[model samples]
Target chain A: MIKLSELHLGILAALGGIVLLFASANFAPLPGQAYGAGTMPRLIGWCAILLGCFMVATSLKHLPEMAKPHLADWVRKPRLAFAALACLAVIVFYILFAETLGFLPTSFLGLLALMLVLRTKWPTAILASLATTLAVYYAFSRLLMVPLPRTEFLSFLG
Target chain B: MLIFEQAAALVFDPYVLGVILASAIFGMLVGAIPGLTATMATALLVPMTFFMDPVPAIAAIVTATAMAIFAGDIPAALLRMPGTPSSAAYVDDAYKMTQSGRGDEALGAALVFSAIGGLFGSIVLMTLAPALAEVALRFSSEEYFWLVLLGLSCAVFVTPSSPTRGLISLLFGLFVATIGMENPSGEPRFSFGNLELMAGIQFIPAMIGLFAISEILRTVTATIPRQKIPRSDGHGIFKTQWKNLKKYPVQTVRGNITGTALGILPGAGADIAAWISYAISKRFSKTPEKFGTGHVEGLVEAGASNNSAVSGAWIPALVFGIPGDSITAIVIGVLYIKGINPGPTIFINDPQTVYAIFMVFILANLIMLPLGWLAIRGARPMLSIPPSTLMPMILIFCIVGAFAIANSTAGIVMMLIFGIIGFFMEENDIPIAPAILGMVLGPMLEQNFITSMIKADGDIFRFFERPIAGGLGVFTILIWTLPLVMLLLRRRKQARLAT
Candidate 1:
């Protein structure tokens, strides 16, 4: 069963091993530092391992019922999953093309793609995305002076 | 204190006052929106801070963050949807009250309790930050190592959800912290030879990707092509609800204390504070059964706790360079960029600035009441707008916000990556807060721990040498241990009953 006790014991055991590994690490014979870098991490690593192991042991002894999960229960929703993926794709496109296309074009295109995937009206999506992109661009470039990538194609708009 | 005088000067400044008012309105608007967050507002505004004086910039950012934190409750109260993760715990409770025609009362309670919580946390920050920073200053690598361990240890017990999940999340975070570059050796320990891994994780973007982007992904799937908005029955949302609030002062106070304490811990933000406060309030409530079924006490506690957390989060920032949460992490970055280094030296070097910032805290909270009211009043009309019209705008903002963080295309890529992670995690019912916490604290934990062991020559006892470290370590153990002990006792009782 997936009770807190079992989880605790598992954590403790894992942490214990980590601690030992760090404790055994050589901090001395390294370059010109008063203390070796591995020293603090190793110490904390040990503490974490000990504490984690203790938790696993404690959980196994009690609250065993908490570990029992209903594996049969599963999400059947498809639209939600698809939408989530679409959002991801748009973001990736924005990141990959933001440099070549510039902030406004890239953001506008990302928003347009997301809007299409979400099934928004074309006019509303296009206008809103463009306006929003322009506003943020102005706010950042003119007001904040955070250097934004500008393309040679868009330079004609100036 | 001589520091208090400069605080007075800063508080009296009209520009500072105006920005606080602007921030409150901004916070309410963002918080009221379903997809937006205070962190986004803060990140977007960080660039603007480069143009202003330090005092005004800090005033604007802090005020907005505090107000926005409170603003999240508005949508949660009005719609069944939560505006932010911090408000998620109370959405059902508050929305249930709204459905039963107690929307005004619920709104009023949230407004008042948020102010109280913010005030309480601010007081704690003002009274304790300088002193704490002085102690934190004494911490060389050895002390910091212990302190970080104490914090991680506390997470084992302090998470508002299942203790096991909390500890698992903490461990996961600790593990991630081990990735990337090594300080002592200047050699990459966890990078596995990747150049990108050498810089470690680009923490802020990773956090944004995990928490913000992931959230978007999860919601995208479940978002009905046409989501239904349940209309309110012509109720007066702005009407004050003093009668209900007066009935639960104790709940509000407890919420404030818990929220403030949680907020003071780095990476533990308002969401955890709200959940923890709500849980504690429920435990002590005489009518515990009414909790998820529209309990006013739950709302008061949740609202107060989250708002208070905003102020409590400032404590770590002011005292040490360490940020209490992600937003504060960005704030620390801003402070450092402005040449105003935090830590013990800050108070000694510029007591007046410290006091001034504290005064901003008080002023921001007070200003929040009116600002919150106006935003709630104004945004109600906007809330009715269909998601189809709004979703595109939000998507644009997300892209811009992502690009704006580091002005790099790679940051946008990072956002998408984390967004996918966040979405999957959410669908699986895994909390994203821990991921953000991990991203923020991972490097700090690694650096401090490594430094400490090097100092003590691998003697773990060096962590316990200081009274503070010892106390913190013990406290961390107590948190994880107590839960296990209680669970054991309950199981024994159950077994006896069964037999």
Candidate 2:
């Protein structure tokens, strides 16, 4: 919902770059070498910082406008924003519950909830999600042989 | 000729042929869906490629990517949504063509020209690859570093967006590549003590999140009314293309050449090729003012350009173990997974696979004709799928695709995080392609830089001592500084005019 102007993004980038430089300050270099694990990262940090500064400098003439905060249109519409958040929520939910709930139940719940949030009818959402979850499970685990986590308790679905 | 027979034998197997057919369908379906990209399709194919043999696996990716790049034109022509960024270059022209009741012709030209362009690039790839590999074999670390840098430069500067944003995206990608413990020091740089972080970010999940999930999020938030596809006037698709081909033979050849050249450049891909070719097409057009008004001229050129560029990108990937585009970046990963490490020695060590890959390119482009025709015929149904239902379906696939990568939840978590980042970056106008390229090329850049630095004993000027390295170094430096020079000159000229 938040729309950060280039100026703000630039500032954030600069701060991030600085923080990266500090965080990797103690990364041990390869033996008898000055550059190592931190070398490329350090170079990236510097580049980011420079780019951030460039962004800030170029926008300096429009500082007032750059400082003005704005909200994306989706932010004004809670329903749309919630639908977007629902996407992230589904992923987080599956991650937290997949092992305990098993892949099927967790995936089904996630898919159905997302579909319903997006305003699909409950019947269609449930049916489609059920079919999708089953199809995906079979395609990946059976056909592709990815070892998706199985529920310890939900043996039938497992 | 014996080599051709061997390659033909390898690819003609039922298993490999089946892979090609299945992947072609997958490519078309994925490409027809608005907001999904060919690169995303390749990323999704990685896990499936894991179960197959080397030839079939590589064949699947090759066929899928070539088909997908061409298929992206379908939605661009019909719905004005541009299924992939490559199609975005001339989406307006395509949609206008549809609006003016030339939808069938626009699509027809796109399919035919795309096939021809892809074929042209494939031929170039076939003929040029072995010789190029010989040259690449002579490349030292200094040459490679400059080449990668040049590629990154092309990625940033070539886009129609702000170069700053492109740089930001690219830097983010390079930073992502630096996350693990496999750097020059073998010390974990940014793991933060997380075990998964030590292994580094999985490329496929991150790519899926960046492209697919972010696209879903964008679709959900978008307000544009989905265009109602104009009913086909039944003018027949390919009927008009013959005249178009004869009319624009020069543009066709130019587009193919530009696309293939750019494609061969690491980090430059079909999107840039299409854009550049479309620009060139307009520049050379007798009726340049007719552009952006449903003119098939731009579409014909750009359509051909994008597919050819798709083939062109394989040159560096096959010869130098460097990716020519995001799709080929994933292909390189698959190639490594299949134990077909892409490099100069690949021609010497695995001639059949190399030739088979070339043969696959030709076959993929040829197969695109019938499959593409079917996709155009079926575009209406594909376009009818509402975003509300479709987004959720794609999201599930993204989840499963990510999860399938390592059979770990880490991949999913990475996807979610990247999805958010990608959505954020898109909203801010930072291009995602450069970031993807950066991620793909970052390790190569660092590896080459460090190796060169160590070899040269930290003498900076030593980087330009070698002939080819010197030439490449000068070219890269010029590319970086040329804009600045031109900018200053333009300002001075404006001052003089004002006075």
TM-score of each: 0.72, 0.80
lDDT per residue (tens digit) for residues A1-158 in model 1: 11123464465447555754654375452565555445445644665676566666666655556355432111345655566566767767766777788776887787877777777788877887788778867765765466777767777643
Query: In model 1, which runs have C-alpha deviations exceeding 4 angstroms?
Result: A1-82, A139-148, A151-158, B1-16, B19-58, B68-110, B122-167, B182-186, B192-194, B223-248, B254-359, B378-389, B451-468
C-alpha lDDT of residue B389 in model 2:
77
Return the lDDT, model 2, position B67. 88
lDDT tens digits, residues B1-499, model 1? 6568777887678887787777667666666655456787787678778887778889888888888787878877875546666776677677787767676667777887888899999998988776643543455664445445554543343334455555555555555555556455665655667776676666546655665565454345443443444455555544455655578878877888888877876656786677667766776789877877777888888899998888888888877778877789899988888889988788888778788888888888888777777776775664465554565565555565555656776666766766665655555444555544454456666666656666767788877787877776666566557767988999999999999
Candidate 1 CAPRI classification by DockQ: acceptable
DockQ of each two-chain model: 0.32, 0.63
Fnat per candidate, as a fraction, reads 0.53, 0.78
**Per-prediction tally of clashes:** 33, 0
In lDDT terms, which candidate is top? Answer: 2
For all candidates in order, the CA lDDT equals 0.68, 0.83
